[model samples]
Target chain A: MKTTPEQSEQRDGTATGPGAGLGTRERIVRATARLMQRQGYEGTGIKQISREAEATLGSVYHFFPGGKQELATEAIRHGDREFAEMLRRALESRPDPAEAVLAVAKDVAAELRASDWLDGCPVTATSLGTAAHAPDIRLAASEAFERWRGLVRDKLLACGFGAQDALELAHTVINTLEGAEFTAQVARDEEPLLIAGRHLARLIDSYR
Target chain B: MKTTPEQSEQRDGTATGPGAGLGTRERIVRATARLMQRQGYEGTGIKQISREAEATLGSVYHFFPGGKQELATEAIRHGDREFAEMLRRALESRPDPAEAVLAVAKDVAAELRASDWLDGCPVTATSLGTAAHAPDIRLAASEAFERWRGLVRDKLLACGFGAQDALELAHTVINTLEGAEFTAQVARDEEPLLIAGRHLARLIDSYR
Candidate 1:
């Protein structure tokens, strides 16, 4: 679910520069990311990925020799990279740390709504379902989680919390958002996210 | 993976009522819960469930005539029941609310480790992955979540928080635990649970 290129290029409408905006490899990965984010690894198939990416089956095999496992792992890693950047942009813009945390939750909820709940955390289902069989995917997911946690901790530290306190708060931030996203998607309502935001805001404020 | 019949029977070795101790139907459901809890919906197969449950294919078909979907939805629903009971018991024994919360997290973490991380929220991955394909399972999961949340809110209220505040706190408590369990399993460690336990304890104490 880590769509590596978070910028969401226009998909290079014209075939003039096939490799310019998003080449064959990029398309396959992006398509995999999108599908995996929604339906997860087991729910998605290689042919579907090839079709969605608009890449020829031959090209998909060419780009990913190991096929779905390789393709999904790469897709997840790509999503991991892009999401970390998205989180940074969402959180860094707000000057106040506590406010920034709440903003991050709400902003992510908006993103979920924008994607029609198709994109929660690329890693949630994708990792849990696939990790037992694919160690590489598990490692990628774990790394992505650590990256997100580190960012949240740093933000809290900047906001004047002690290191231990910041670490704990950081965990709370990610944990609530992750669970909230799952519930929101299941219920097909954004209320869970908003509730999470309000409760998280109170939790953050209680730091005083 | 709702484990119904949550009174925690000792697995009646020599059933006074034959098929009561580890009955074929119950075994199939329990096996499905374990497999689905770890591997999720699409990742688990009926044959595997049959083998794991030590039941014949005919018996499996007899128990779950509708096959995988039927068995899985039943499994998740069963897990929901069992988990609600587990949550109730975990949260009920302690007199001090904050300490109870911490103890619940720790006890569950211990349980997760005992199962080698195979026993996370029974419906977590199962519900998220199948809710789109099966609405009944989704409803069961939502109902189970609300039931659990109500229990937690009641606990918080008993601990002296206002009704509104208790509701929000209950949501946070569940949210954090769900996400932390996912992370801890993926990372193959219990630190996330302990981290969540501490943060949740502090959050609970803030109300006082």
Candidate 2:
């Protein structure tokens, strides 16, 4: 349960002292992404974003003219890149797709537990909260999922699976992980996620 | 795309003309559940619930003095009952656990499509939006998920699976379906759900 200084700051939702070296715009986007990870779109506000980023309100508007919506879109993109990077690293960790799937799940569970289950998939929490109301935000989330699926699909294909099987399993992998993460966060336990990972690995092995 | 009268009413978020025969409290709870399915707890309000239910603000307060949070908990319970009923019927439709998992997925996809993808899991949407802030709502959602996993586990056990396998696969079933449903709704397509369902059926068969 002991968190590092950076993790403690994120848990408090206060100033992002670790990111002080980064630029103002990057700080704002990262701050927004972090906030949206815990609370959904409706629960977050531009004023709070400013406070967390340690930037003035005027600087926030100057960086993003469209206000919260624009800032949130960028945050979604930021989260997307981070997750994609994680997926890339995990996919490369194992030669076999089945083991790779398990690795991805383990990584996600570790991250969630590290945050004390307070953090969840950034795209899912925000997109589900807004639903059809925010087209831009929804589109960002949709693209993030698609990219993750694509990365998995490619790994499966390279591992010698057919296109259809790879495509279907890719969808299953992302969907299951997204679902397991939400369940784990709510229960404040990592068992659901780890179980999901084990089952997904078995599923991939069956296809092989 | 064609909807019945009741479905159309829900789409418009207008008066529940079809539920005129139900009691005032039932109508209020149903309305809250329906609204929360599309929008999370934070996005919904007491005024909208009263209007949708065709009940006065006084009636709403009279039934639940705790206001939105109390009503939302009831709505989660209502949603839990409805989903549990659906799971029962689906599980009963097929003797095999694999087929039953597919049936549950198909039913969920059909329901979402019938609602024009405006609807999602009632508990997930509300809980993720509020997350850790509303203890009652969070507890209600947690209980709902546990009940669902239990139902699935019971089915697997009846089909001759061991206790450990049943429990883990049941978690996988609920978690995967929940994830696929959210992805399908976000993409405005049912393919993710159906794909997840197909893969889940295969996973169950492998267990056999």
Candidate 3:
């Protein structure tokens, strides 16, 4: 049997689905995340996700009876948590919290360049596309943000900052990082992110 | 003749267009802005814009020979500038720069609540929808961010900060505020923005 180009790409699992080894259901979720990261929620198509996941359209419905909205909600929640964990692990490589943040920022910068600026946290992007009708997706995105904030807050707590200051600084870092990502993508440059990283490092140092 | 609901809405021009007194061409632009603000670039339909604007479908093509993309580009540019002006005027009503920022944040929070969270910075939302394929729209959004950043920089310079620090602080404030707005929308609360405002005010105070 001959495979089409999109099917061949899916068979290789390269263009999308970093976790191609996952089950069919999870593969669909990953593919949804990858597509949404680039084209955003409305821009991403279900047919594309089905092809990318190497699953039939029926499988998508089987896994998510609520259709694209359900898949999108899962993708947002999964992508955000997975990205935050990767950031956390990479950040742990440095001994100092400030340096760790700088290091993580550098890592994300490299990833952005590698992805040709196609990748971003899709939670807010998805929320923008669905906020009118899907309250559950909005709430899921909010939880994802809170979880990411906790990552920063935990690092500060470990760095010996008090809870109050840690919480405040966490908000600052998360807000700055997310904003920089948007600016960086639009500008087609990573300098905004690098500058944000430096500023966060300085901010953390001040608290230290 | 008595008007139907949608016709009444179009005549009043209040369900969407903030500028109810606008001419037909301008009304089309304003209606596009309002729908795009709620549903994003891909989600907003040109027919809907025409209906909301009370303009004929023929007029849409007449104004935008370039079609939906062209209309979208115009809508984003006009909406962002108009919204910024309103924010600027209101922000200027306060005496001090810090107070002005806080006031602006408060005003946006109120607006968000009133709009049922349908309103956001349409420039960023539109860019996300167009980022993968449309370079023109992305550049428009980048310019819009620059314009907004200038708003903060001007205030900082007036508040006696050095030119370099003013620019940096201005970036910080814009990035944080944009990011906070996203977070607030997802959370369905204004606390993120309020916290961001207070932090920005403190940063400005330190420079002062």
Q: List fnat per candidate, in order.
A: 0.58, 0.73, 0.61
Candidate 3: docking tier: medium
Candidate 1: regions farther than 4 A off: A1-21, B1-20
The numbered model that scores best in TM-score is 2
At residue A56, candidate 1 shows an lDDT of 74
Candidate 3 steric clashes = 0
User: Would you give me the overall lDDT of model 2?
Assistant: 0.87
Residues B14-64, candidate 2: write the lDDT tens digits. Answer: 344747655667789988998887788878888998888887898899889
Query: DockQ numbers for every candidate?
Result: 0.55, 0.65, 0.61
Quote the RMSD, in angstroms, for model 1: 5.5
Please give each candidate's TM-score: 0.88, 0.91, 0.88
TM-score quality measure for candidate 3? 0.88
Better of 1 and 2 by DockQ: 2
How do all the candidates rank in terms of DockQ, highest first? 2, 3, 1
Query: Which DockQ value does candidate 3 get?
Result: 0.61
Interface RMSD of each candidate, angstroms, one decimal: 1.6, 1.1, 1.3
Candidate with top DockQ is: 2
Give the Cα error of residue B139 in candidate 1, in Å: 1.8
Q: Between 1 and 2, whose lDDT is larger?
A: 2
What TM-score against the true chain A does chain A of each candidate get? 0.86, 0.91, 0.87
The parts of candidate 3 lying over 4 Å away from their true place are A1-21, B1-20
